[model samples]
Target: MSDAAVTADLETYLSERVRSTPPSGIRRFFEIAATMDDVISLGIGEPDFVTPQPAVQAGIDALNDGQTSYTANAGRADLRTAISEELSSRYGVSYDAEDEILSTVGVSEAMQLTMLSVLDPGDEILIPEPCFVSYAPTARFAEANVVHVPTSVENNFQVTAETLESYITPNTKALFLGYPNNPTGAVLRRDTLEDIAALVQEHDLLVISDEIYDRLVYGEAHERGHVCVPSIDGLRERTILLGGFSKGYAMTGWRIGYACAPAPILRGLYKVHQYMIMSAPTVSQIAAHTAITECQDEVETMRQAYDERRRVLVDGLNEAGLPTFEPEGAFYCFPDIRSTGLTSEEFVQQLLEEEHVACVPGDAFGPSGAGYVRCSYATGLDDVKEAVRRIQRFAAKHQNG
Candidate 1:
């Protein structure tokens, strides 16, 4: 058929929900940074380290032994068992491997499936502002509305019970909690989590706690371990916990993660998983199982390195006259750029072009991030130092200008 004839007969069809979804702000920055040379990039949230040796070997062994076929929709029995045991031993939260956990392609897929399974059109989910970008869009994709609860830097970006209470609506179905968060790298202290837990319990809202960065904590002694909201009173039944091997074990390419929730939610999530992805890769599951069960020491070593990098980056930013908040977890330093009198996007762009340093704009996370920028310290210490120097030079030049 001729082009005009073909085009005239049919209008392009697309789902209204899909058509309305916004592109990921984080990814857009990454694409822009990719074209530049000599750029010291702090844009992405990935770990700089390679996957731990043990996990890599386990994956190799699985493939060599012909473990390539698909596994159960809920994931392999051994992997789920390992995950359940690890969660119980590490966090004091009990979940039945058979009925309470489902392995996912990644925490990303788990988030998508959870939203799809729990939310309906017009329902609302509460997300704290400057959160990981995926939460709002994922909720939107599931035909749910997102209510952003802003958390400020003065409070160390912690989401308090009062803030959560104020955002609750009649249609609110869940709250997205990301501790050791992206961009800001802020974590919720135990007492704060306890209060928030109590508030969620009172309101009868479900909690989708995104604890993917739980193992990346890098601060005081008491802040290192993951704190499950379920550990608090009455939260276990109402909370769906998300975790992954990507950040903790440097297994990003493996694409293996799991969700722990009530049995009913798990069932719904599994149904969605079955249709969307029959199972996470079988070899990756085996590798993840081994990593969680036996790779604690390796994970700790990486965490220590990240801790040093975090300190270096945060200190350097402060020294360079950029007001920065110390991150309790995750290998990122989000510094306020308001002093520069430039919007976050402009600040990042100028830094990348002039200083050959790449970092994401804070506004990409949410509206509250307008005057800030996120710098990832997940690279080598040398790279972090160099990036800081470039930033300092850029700041000095701009100040003089």
Candidate 2:
């Protein structure tokens, strides 16, 4: 094509779906951080700890043994079996390793497979707001309409049955749920999940439950244990469970995650996954297998560290005038930044520029997350402490600005 023709027609060549969707709001700050030096970032939900030694060793051992070829499309039998056993042991839920699980590049891919498999164009997914940034976008990419159900700090930032019911329509096909939620670190309790499960069954809705942070619940949540939505009585057949090694095992770069559902649902998900990705990286799958089966102590140790960081960061933010809520899961503290008299983006940008401290604005998650900022305590404790100090200084200068 001629340059003139290319220039004129390029705009039309793009898919409406791809063009209409907005780029990541989190990446806006990341681009700015890239151009700077000496910035302390609380922006990413990544663990600072190295992958546990045993998992790392397992990956190395697998590679050294030349186990590099692809395994079954569903994933290695041993790995799937390990995951199945872990689910049963942890959640009292049993999933057949043969047909109920599909492994993918990451929970990110697990989400994509589930959404694409289940949602028809124009179908709507009811998502709780103040969610992870990807939930709505991924649903939209699947050609599904996204209806955000408002969840607030007043309810510990969780979607209630009342709010969820208000958004339901005949077109509503699924509920996209993430808890031990991102940006807010709020884990749903049994009573709340039971209520939602009842609604799900009543509505005949499919559920995409992202439980990536299930192992990180703290204090009361840790004691009660995170509830698997699919494990709730009759909801299992209708739920797609999404999880990965990134949060729980600090294997973000390994890019391994999985999905579990009833055979009928999982069959569709697996077909999509088989065509899109033949298998997750074999070495990473081994690493994940080792992590799940042999690294319970390491997982607990890391969770403890995050818990300590959580308390310190939340207390420091409140003392710094950011007025943070106590987060019970995940590694973030979403503090109200409206007190600084700036929008979420402005507060984050200004803090980054003036204090060399970086955090994600709440608006990146959803409009309900506006007037707040998500600070990740996934960095070193000292860095978190210093970030608190820097943020306090910025807040003091700008509180009335």
Candidate 3:
């Protein structure tokens, strides 16, 4: 066959879902920023801290001890035990390490595994947006129809029980929750979580709670902080809990995370996980175990830094006329630029061109994100301050003209 025929044949063989999912809108700006040296980039959600010394030393120690082989398909028992223990103490959720936990590449893989394992073709999953960019796409990739429950900044971008109820249909099989949510950094309060937990019982819905930023949750004493969804009454049995070392531990590149579920649900996830990823890296598993056991202080230290930067940046944006809501968790500040009369993309692009500052367009998360842009405070404090200053100047010139 000719070249065109061969290409067409391959395309025909590929699934439509695979072809239709768009590339990450986050990385597109990164590519543009890569070509410039002067850009103050707040586009990515990566921590500025180095990996904790104990974790780094643990990996180095493992390498020195020649620990470079593939672990069990379910990952190292000790690491799983550590995870299980931590979850038990921290969230009041219990699981047997051997049968109920499976370590994956990261929460990224955990999410995909959960969606694929639970979602039959034609089943529906409700996703709250603007959330992490992956949730909607991963569900679609699993051949599930993704129904978006749009949450607005007016409501603090939280999914209320009423909002979730409105989206449910007979085919809806699960709900995806990402608290201390990305972009908006909106953490659901306890009452709100109880509301969602009630829905889970009412509908018998499966849930995938991505709590990667659980450890990073911070707010005033008056406001309730991150509530682990599985710890809620009537939710643990059906929820597939996803978490990782990436954000809280400053180990993004290590690519290590884990999932926990009831034994039956875990069995389904393992079938997808085993064939796709035999095991997570031995070094990372060792490192994560050490960190979880020994590095609580280091995690708190990093959280303190993010909290300080979050305060300064959010306040600066609000004073700059951008109207940024204080993000109670995570490292991002989603500032409303609608008052400037610019779409998210237009604001992001022109700011990059004019001020050489790079923040992601909030619309990258979903259509509801159009009037905002997500500025990550994960960069250094100096850079965060300077970026806010530049943004203020930019906003003045564009002041709804």
- Summarize candidate 3's per-residue lDDT along 162-237 as a digit string, tens digits: 9999999999999999988998989888788888999888998998999999988777711455688888888889
Q: TM-score, each model?
A: 0.96, 0.97, 0.96
Candidate 1 clash pair list: none
How large is the C-alpha RMSD of every model relative to the true structure? 2.1, 1.5, 1.8
Off by over 4 Å in 1: 1-11, 221-224
Model 1: per-residue Cα lDDT over 151-237, one tens digit each:
899889998998888888889889889887887988888889889888887888999988898788875723546677678778899
- On residues 74-167, what C-alpha lDDT tens digit does candidate 2 reach at each position? 9999889999999999999899999998888999999999989999999999999888888888888889999999888899897898889999
Top candidate, metric TM-score: 2
Candidate 2 or 3, higher TM-score? 2
Candidate 1 vs candidate 2: which has greater TM-score?
A: 2
Query: Candidate 2 at residue 326, lDDT?
Result: 80
lDDT (C-alpha) at residue 64 in model 1: 99
lDDT of 2: 0.91
Give candidate 3's error at residue 210 in angstroms: 0.3
